[model samples]
Target chain A: MNGVRKAQTSPARSRFRDEDLPGYLFMAPWILGFLLFTLGPTLASLGLAFTKFDLLSPPQWIGVDNFTFMFTQDQRFWNALRVTFVYLLLEVPLKLAFALAIAMAMDKGIRGGDLYRALFYVPSLLGGSVAIAVLWRQLFQGDGVVNQVLLWLFGVQGPSWISNPETSLYTLVILAVWQFGSPMIIFLAGLRQIPAELYEAASIDGATRWKQFWRITLPLLAPVLFFNIVFQTIEAFKAFTPAFIISGGTGGPVDSTLFYTLYLYQEAFAHFRMGYASALAWVLLVIIGVCTTLSFLASKYWVFYEDER
Target chain B: MSAEAGPGQVGSEPTIVGVIARHVLLIAGSVLMLYPLLWMLASSFKPEAGIFSNLSLIPPSLNPKNYIDGWNALEVSFSRFYWNSFLIAILVVIGNVMSCSLTAYAFARLRFRGRNILFALMMMTLMLPYHVTLIPQYVLFLNIGWIDTILPLVVPKFLAVDAFFIFLMVQFFRGLPRELDEAAKIDGCGPWRIYWMIILPLSKPVLATAAIFSFLWTWNDFFGPLIYLNDISRYTVPLALRAFVDSTGTSAWGQLFAMSTLAIAPIFLFFLLFQRLIIRGVAMSGLKG
Candidate 1:
């Protein structure tokens, strides 16, 4: 078999010497696209971060002034950051835990699992759209279904979830948690990879189900959990559409739902502060990078792979 | 795939009470999850005053006026938005399939200097948020006079700018046996022939996944069209839906709900028809990552 493979590839190697051109040609679209769209814009945004460009006027170099303004002067910048962090804190853990629990429940081999999985996944499929965001606004309105249900069932008046300043951000968080299908699906896939014999061995060894989960499931599923955490955190940070639609694109109710991206978008488009927005965008990139790196470093302690073992 | 394992072991059947309890919990969760969507659908059929006043899923009367008003509520009809979304989604699906599969073929089956570095760069692009690239991309499109056109939204897709699809296709391509390519090469099949004839034909599942995801994402995309297309005439469904609600909250809520329901109907239908492929695609992405 090895000799046959060697014999096959030797002539192909000679032919492939000239075939690099086709290979490169095939890759040209992505290469050109990356250079023009991603790389070029990344560098341009970096340069623009230090300049004042509002699309009409030529970009004026202002050297670190944008950063200084963000650091020292902009209260809304701080508010956006605080709101985003609160959102991240509330969203990432709750969504992941909820997804993991549901995935574990599903892992017990429920009848018609596919139907349940598909139904559960519907929200995520519609989660990012403007239509769903509008629906969320209606659902949380003062006289909407949520409040109506509260009044009917508990005889308590429900606050306008999206309109109330104190509760508006939580409404977005709840929305984030409600669309837990993606991570739940991921966790389910991960659960399938855990060998069944491990559970059998644990059970034979007199391990309780709860103990088996702690000993077998969580440890083996750590890498998947870590992945989900990192992904969901980044996603939570970048959430825009829900907040945009809910707050009428203003990040309002006194900036209660002013997500970092929404604020950046308002600065860039609504106010035409492209330079300031560029600065905000760079800061967001750094924050995400730092969070990702920290997670990677943290994963060293807990995230185990079968190959690594 | 292993045979289905019970919560404990193979021989032990779960208690009927336990099974019933699981179903009960699942049913409750499903209702909670599905309530918003059902409420929206119900509200679409309700009268304007009945929308906020009555919380019943059963409208007092099955009024279809909301649908009629919503269809023509804005300056442009909902058909224009739906047509625009479909046109963009179809083009995006084509672009992603054509460009990403080619790129994935090159990365998977071919070798060149800087191949690893380029692949790494492509993977790195996955982590870079679109917001970081939004301003400069907007500026570039503006400079090229592609603003207010679908070109900005549709063109980058042809270039395989979305690295997620490229990565997905690469994973699929790499899983194919190398012997097939070798056999094709011995048969005097060129790279193009091997890719188009051999690889593409063999990759229906991944291709279907890619096409479905690209269509769904493009159909639901709000930001790209929001930033690029300025005219209401050129607006996609998401933008058109946003136009239903004015800032003052005095806008037509019933019409908005009606149009919103109609907007998501295609996605809901698509999800139902292609649920298996979609779930598998999502699972493949998550597990591979």
Candidate 2:
């Protein structure tokens, strides 16, 4: 058997080692796909930033014109940036706090914990979809569930959440916060990793429950907390479906829920400003990258990796 | 090993004030989480006029006809939409599992030239906001004539386009014992055999994790289907629901809610059936890694 196998393999073995080939062979499809799809598109998007392509005509070589328009004269660009920043600032912190609080509660050996976790997670899974956004619009509409409940409970009228300019943005913010499950699950996992002995030691040392949580739990869970915050922050900045559906694909009632991605999408697909949208896409990438980097830099002071210190 | 083993033995019953506060907070939070769903169910039974009348958690009377009407009103078959989503989600899950796990296995265990750089590049893909590549991706799909079909939705996953899943699988693979591989090699098994017979079996927990997440994300995905699938017949549930609402100008709230409930039901059923796997998967995929 060995002689026969050797005879069969000798020709190919002389040409190339099988072990060396398998890994590359296994990886070849992925590598090829990434190059053709992601890598090429990334480079093209960057190049398109310098052109004036709109899909209807050949891309004109209008060097720096898109970026120039975006920076020097675009009111809507600034508006989108303003809207997205305000959203990130409010939504990220609120979402983290809500998830952390719920995770802490979940960690306390609460009864029906799994049910609660599943319940909280449902909204997160639903929030990213256009259907949920439609549901949200209905719930917050003038004659929707929210208003009905408000009227029933308090005998007061409620505003049209998707249409009212003053409150429309806040409605989307609430939608963002409602999808806190992913982060909460992370927090719960982080909480589980905090050894019971540390809490015992703290309690034995006369620390109150809150104090133990503040000192032992908070410090130890910092790495996980940091991860949740960074991930949620990026996600919040990418908020699109809710805004798009709620705003009726126009980014109005007065662009109140005009998230950055939604605006970029409009530029690309709606108005066929592919080149200019490409520029906006690049700018958004830089913005997100900078935010993520800043989060990592700030983590040095707070996020407590086990071996890093 | 369990809650019974823990040291929370302070069994003193709380005072009335504490009891009220705790119950109030707990109930309030639970209501906040459950209210929308409850209202959705109730609204689906409410008459068109009753929809915005009381804003109450309870409807005055049930209108079962709304569901019948909603089903009949869709220009395209709703069952076809469900089939589209279901088929695409299954394909995505299977593709993601095989391709992502293979790529992740290579990254996690194999030592090769430029391995670290390639891994870093994969990680960098996660940081690149998806919208940046979405337009170009759309154009590419258009050029390939795959835009009008479900190919755009499922094929990329087969190519391991999802860096997040790859990262997740890499983390899971890293935590596994190296002895498993060595044992397989000593038994004269090749890498593929080891991966198939040993690593894959041991990876059930994380594989379930990847599968459940992929299923949920794929099922809930609207933007990809919305962009590529211009044909109404090819629309997924989310896209179909959007179309349903758009056609009516102000959709019959009761029927719309019913349809929304139907759209959400499959996922809810999935969560119920595999609750344990999902919880474990969510835990493993989180920062505890």
Candidate 3:
């Protein structure tokens, strides 16, 4: 529709008069996918959030009932929300701190940085796999290596961390922090963008190492730090595979590791509560959306772009 | 790469003690980082009896039994799972590279009406969480009888459902000199010819990046396979790995570890070979403009 209007409005803009046919033909698959897969399904998810639908029966529009049920009725919904926020708030900063700290250390032009980089990166590379999840379960089980180490070192017995309701979520937090290489690399790249001369100037001004870090590094790295925080927040909020695999897809041990996605999976796939799950999904979208918008808005206060303003 | 921006070396050159201390700290951190994976690898090597009791890093004997037995631990051999995952990953790579690049070509070079609006819409998808579409998509597939099959996972890739690749390729395509397109057009070449001959040939890096990530992500994907593939015979490696955890007995972690080790082999090998490219790909994505 806009093609016709644009073709009429601005014929001189196109060298060949109009690219409607060729462009549409090339983008046909994506456009079809947008309509069929993403856009269509997304709109359906919103509509379904308001109704009751099982595959057996047609959708029954019960206006705002699903939302009401979520807000007023469900215990697991509140638990899932609490768990997700805890995980997100805990992991984002923990992960980014490790990332930035290590990125700073490795950014020191250390020899064998590649080997260290590879070892550091391997976890993040393999972190999403079931193998890592399986390994995490093994490492923190009652008779696991972690307990073995604790006993061997401190002569203290550690509980089965993965199965312990009190510690299961922390294990996931540790897992999140372990895969710090991706953000660390980003921090490294961000550090690279900061001119070395800034540090040199600080040194010439008799700035201490700690002073240079605060004066020259943190402020300049704020934008990248902001990006990492925002990026990691979204990733941690959506964390499912490790939680699912480690918790054996139940988010169990009394739902301590019940990530929001895991709960949504159970609601939708396990129970086939498509409508309720849609409501849960919309809540998640809002959470992620709000967190992202807030981060962007909040960054204006704290994120110092050296070049932008 | 050698440029140092970290603030520690600020006032003076480092002393030998400081250098040694830093090296020791880094090495310690590196060991800590790799310990879990290394422990898994070691456990995979140890005999079943010693796996739990032995906290040692090295196995007493390098038993190949777990690798052999775990291969057939299930009703179907683990090779089938590998093959299923491999097949799906290859298809996903091909679909993503072809479809995303095609769409990206139009976005980068073609002056279509609604181009900017569509591009913005595509970018919007980069942040839109997939869970919002998960149930409706499941219903969509169930209605079409495509549930419980690889079609649900593999087919959307062909339609460029992953907008990230489209965006990545668009960035790379935009970097190419547009004069080349005009030159090709003057030689009686259509946009398709320019895309196939001029653009694709020059786009090997971006294409390879897209393909590698496509394969890696699909191989690592658990949710899609978990939700879609019901039969054990059709399970991907990650799904089979999860199922192994479910089915394994208390003493069978050795076998689970074995299979898990095999599951990581492709990614490990990919990292070994393409470390620079992989790291660069991640770094580039993180440094989004």
| Interface Cα RMSD in Å, per prediction | 2.8, 4.0, 2.5
Tell how far residue B116 is off in model 3, in angstroms.
0.8
What tens digits encode model 1's per-residue C-alpha lDDT throughout A1-309?
Answer: 343456457855554555567879999999999999999999999999999998999999999999999999999999999999999999999999999887876775679777778878899998689989988888888887789888989999988888889999998999999999999999999998888788877767777777777888899889889989999999898899999999999898999999999999999999999999999999999999999999999899998888898
Candidate 3 chain A minimal-lDDT segment of 10 residues: A1-10
> What is the two-chain DockQ of model 1?
0.58
Chain A alone, TM-score for each of the models?
Answer: 0.94, 0.91, 0.93
Clashing pairs in model 1, backbone N/Cα/C closer than 3 A: none
Runs with alpha carbons beyond 4 Å of true place in candidate 1: A1-16, B1-11, B247-251
As for DockQ, the candidate ahead, 1 or 3, is: 3
Q: What TM-score should be assigned to candidate 1?
A: 0.96
lDDT of 2 by residue, A121-230 (tens): 77776658766777888878887777777788899988787788888888888888888887888888888777777766666677766666678778988888887777
How do these models rank on lDDT, best leading?
1, 3, 2
Clashing pairs in 2: A148-B55, A149-B55
Candidate 1 per-residue lDDT over residues B162-254, each given as its tens digit: 899899989999999999998997787878999999999999999999999999989899988999999999999999888887632645788
What's the true lDDT of residue A53 in model 1?
94
- Candidate 1, residue B181: the lDDT equals 94
lDDT by residue for model 3 (A88-206), tens: 88888888888888887777666787787778888899867899989888889998888989999999999999888999999989988999999999888888887777877887887
Question: TM-scores of the models, in the given order?
Answer: 0.96, 0.92, 0.95
